[model samples]
Target: MSSGTASSGAGSDDDHAPWPSPLIRDLVDELRRFNRRKTEFYAESVLEASAFAIMLVLSDGRARTLRELTEELGLEQSTVNRQVNNAIKHGYLERFEVAGSLSRFVRPTDTGREAFHHDGMLRAARIEATFADLAPGTPEGLLRELRAFNQAYDRRVLRETGKDVEATGEHRRYG
Candidate 1:
């Protein structure tokens, strides 16, 4: 038997891999898992994530226009409209027009605000529990790293596809 580190028949390097690196593929996989967990949490809460996002935006007690919400959420206009309509239908939001402005605004109702705060507290507690084993500042560091990685990935996509992927906020299949 060899005394050196034993190889598992296959090497770590994968020049033939489609992705630029294995780490990138792993990162994508982790992000997919994160999103899956988030969706699960929302489902378990008996609320759609989009609706929660709308509630969050309106929870400040300040009226916000649909366009503003769309931009803030980085979601498409149609998606924002649909979520807003749903919220209105559920009586979590009320639409009104400012006297001087042509744009209509949506504000959270008392029920909506209460729900938002309750959900937010629950989510925060869950997150805190999940990270209880981690050292302090680890989550913040990870967030910073993710932000940097996203910026780099955006630049790479722009260079390869000549498209601003971040601006569009759409995932496209790239060769």
Candidate 2:
């Protein structure tokens, strides 16, 4: 948690010095490790991570346009398009247009819903087992803290970039 900066060179100014806080370094390392472990777990699942994410978002049975999905997932249009196309090819998803709308919306097929449920149960079991080994209330506390930290981080990013979350429609989509 050290706030004192460490100099990279003898004459380096404090304003230009990189943050050498142990807390920041540890946070980065732990995040990377968590991501790696999560990736490894998903590698054994039937659906790819992107597909699973899309399915999860569509799990409420509501169809969403590609633009909506891209914005919700915070991914580039090309990436979401590629993933959606792959899911459609696999029969897990389908695209349809509303009667008067030019935009095509994507939704999960029956197979996709079944697969998503199956994978979700598996993931839940794994998480529950892991949580069982932790101290009581630890998981809940961690989740609360993580959510708070993410909100703060997002707010800071928006403020620094002079971007309005509402104007971007992110607050409406996620808030």
Best by lDDT: 2
RMSD, candidate 2, Å: 5.4
Candidate 2: segments with Cα more than 4 A from true spot: 1-18, 42-44, 166-175
Please write out the lDDT profile of model 1 over residues 23-55, one tens digit for every residue. 555555667766676445643463467778777
TM value for model 2: 0.77
The CA lDDT at 52 in model 1 is: 80
What value of lDDT does candidate 2 attain over all alpha carbons? 0.75
Candidate 1 wrongly placed segments (more than 4 Å): 1-16, 42-46, 59-62, 135-137, 147-175
Error (Å) of candidate 1 at residue 162 is 11
Model 1: weakest 10-residue lDDT segment is: 1-10
Clashing residue pairs in candidate 1 (N, C-alpha, C atoms within 3 angstroms): none
Q: How many clashing residue pairs appear in each of the predictions shown?
A: 0, 0
